[model samples]
Target chain A: MPLQNIKVIAFDADDTLWVNETFFRKAEEDFCALLEGYMPKEEANKLLFDMEIGNLPLYGYGIKPFTLSLIEAAIVVSKGTMPIELVQKLIDIGKKMLEAPVELIDGIEITLKELSKKYRLVMATKGDLLDQERKLIKSGLEKYFHHIEIVSDKTEKHYKKLVKHLDIQENEFLMVGNSLKSDILPVLNIGAHAFHIPFHTTWAHEMIYEEINHPNFKSFTKASDLLQIL
Target chain B: MPLQNIKVIAFDADDTLWVNETFFRKAEEDFCALLEGYMPKEEANKLLFDMEIGNLPLYGYGIKPFTLSLIEAAIVVSKGTMPIELVQKLIDIGKKMLEAPVELIDGIEITLKELSKKYRLVMATKGDLLDQERKLIKSGLEKYFHHIEIVSDKTEKHYKKLVKHLDIQENEFLMVGNSLKSDILPVLNIGAHAFHIPFHTTWAHEMIYEEINHPNFKSFTKASDLLQIL
Candidate 1:
């Protein structure tokens, strides 16, 4: 009954709609292996994570920012002695990630297809505008949504703006995605319904230790499960 | 009478609303100076421009893309001989540019304030989402606009979508900006009014040698000049 008033459903792009974090995880492993000569794999990965968090305020989110942070972290881990070829390699890694195929989450297409008929669906992402737009088009799922909402970050304020832009009230909006920090918590805090259908892998940055228990919140393990309730 | 039906005036950010291209030009000079040992300043500048154009489809527009292109161009110019310190300098240069203060165009605040009273004002740009949002807030010009629209590029298709999103007819939308190619030409092609206020320094990439003469087009030398006719 809580979702009865929902007129718009916004789904987070990255891991929510496609296989994103798995690719990032693979990239991180490759990065750590590349820097193994300078630092241990675990240490180098941690350093890269710290570098990304430090740069987040300025760089926002995307493969490009991640690539930039990788270079910066390599510099620090290698003590400013990284070879030029290695730097070039890091740049290529970012581009390859950008060009990577969008592997749709299992059953996401049918889920979106079913929901589109009854609700105004939107793909919301806090990723690079061009990169996400490319993925949306590549996924062959653009036709399912009315439009895409790309934001720099998904904060409560941003959610409020998104709802206002949709010309709907907070209760009339529903957010479905993988990361609780980005797609669920802030949305739930804003008096809207947030249903979490988490991806198998989440970045350490998006991990939360606490369990979520909110009146406007629901949790599901797979995308297809949404149709059972919504 | 031509402008009578306009309800929303979307102003292009960057050089149109503030001092943007000047900063980029200065950054280019500094970048060339850093690579002077490997390539001539003129050649280095041209190479950087070429690198940017080549990467545009993948990277889109914004300081982040420009920064990434800078690093890529430096690698090619130096031919793998550039020291790690130089790469670090390029990274630092990008951060400094991102952190640079927003300098509003002369008399633009007054123009925006005056125009906001009678029309729905929107700040639209093809810049990074966070960067443009920061500039708008820093310029103290956010209050004058109804909302901000960030797009990957400004083409006729993009303008059409913007007008549709604003829930207005083509003629009811007006675009004002410094780049004739970006803000005026495509806008006119879409049957919307486009007012061009030339910025003193235009990016070589945005330069269009052909003069624009369209029924929906008008050119101005400064931002304040818009008040006279609109």
Candidate 2:
């Protein structure tokens, strides 16, 4: 197998490990509904998305940033006349998302359990470190991974640093995740192997409208399909 | 010296290496001033502190959490009748804090540069990973350390994990920081060496009233004082 030389396997945590975007989607719907009087639901949702993108560099990502954006967008949508209770509701939505239970992706546990036997596994994710660590513990999957690598953003430079930290060559590192933007392209660009397993919903910010055809890249329909090869 | 066995030195980032609490102090002042119309500044500041502590378990520590708490506290202080402009101002305050310049504490650079020659230096900090990394880059202190270890909290369990991750024994790890609660107690409790360097200002939430009398611990008046012993 082309992946036979892989010594360290890193998995992206959010959608790849469990249900994340679904909660965000739900929260967005709730926000749009709350402000439907001021603006159309679709338009309000788009505005909130734009606000999030604009704040990405300053706030990074997580429920807290999203909650802040929701509050700001509400103010803009309502022209600073919306009830202050709406702000509280947005904060509650963000808190609820943080407290949401972990829902493991199908066959992910078995996939991790099987793969952990042959290679060193790590959860390489970009978000709030606290939230990711809490999720890993709640998922009861913490034991399967060597450690979690929490980054502000995943880029080629980060991948190179990860490889160096793990004391392995680029060719010996394999990254498996659902996002082509954060996980796959960076790893592949660094001459490491990357596997893509698409999730049901992709955050618009993480969407890349392009076909990837690389020697070090592989795409699978589901998590368990990896067992067929390495 | 008792620290002769220490092979790795992890420094706390916030008030230890640079000015962090001062920013929070300034933000709290601005927050209280904004709501002075609804409540007295002292009472408003106290209420905001209470709100932050209450949200700690759910929100963890960072500027984003603090910003959310400011907004929530504002809502509570005004009983949900505050102007939307105030909310926007709170958001702006948080953004400015994130973009604030990194002011290196006096003698911190020389201390780190000197320590790096004998021990593996790391920034073992409890904060948002991205924010900490950014500060390290801005402080121009990233070059002196081996790597950065960012955690949500600094409990005994977390310190133990850090020591294990460093591939060293308990005695071989030394922690130096400002807070007795987070940086000192936890590290010493885990059978590692810890040094205390008092900062000019301390966050009320991180305050400890008791005197520590650990054999493996040493206290210093400033950052450069560390160079005298090591």
For model 1, what is the C-alpha lDDT against the true structure?
Answer: 0.92
lDDT of 2: 0.93
| Residues B1-230 of candidate 1: C-alpha lDDT, one tens digit per residue | 87989999999999988898988998899999999999999999999999999999999998888888999999999998999998889888889989999898999999999999999999889899999998888999999999999888999988998999899999999999999889999999989999999999998889999877788888888899999988
Candidate 2: tens digits of C-alpha lDDT, residues A7-69? 999999999999899999999999999999999999999999999999998889899999999
Q: lDDT per residue, candidate 1, A163-214, as tens digits?
A: 9999999999999999989999999899999999888888998998889999
**First chain TM-score in every candidate?**
0.98, 0.98
Worst 10 residues of 2 chain B by lDDT: B125-134
Model 1 chain A: ten consecutive residues of lowest lDDT: A145-154
Q: Would you list the clashing residue pairs of candidate 1?
A: none
Q: In order, what fnat does every candidate score?
A: 0.72, 0.83
Worst 10 residues of 2 chain A by lDDT: A1-10
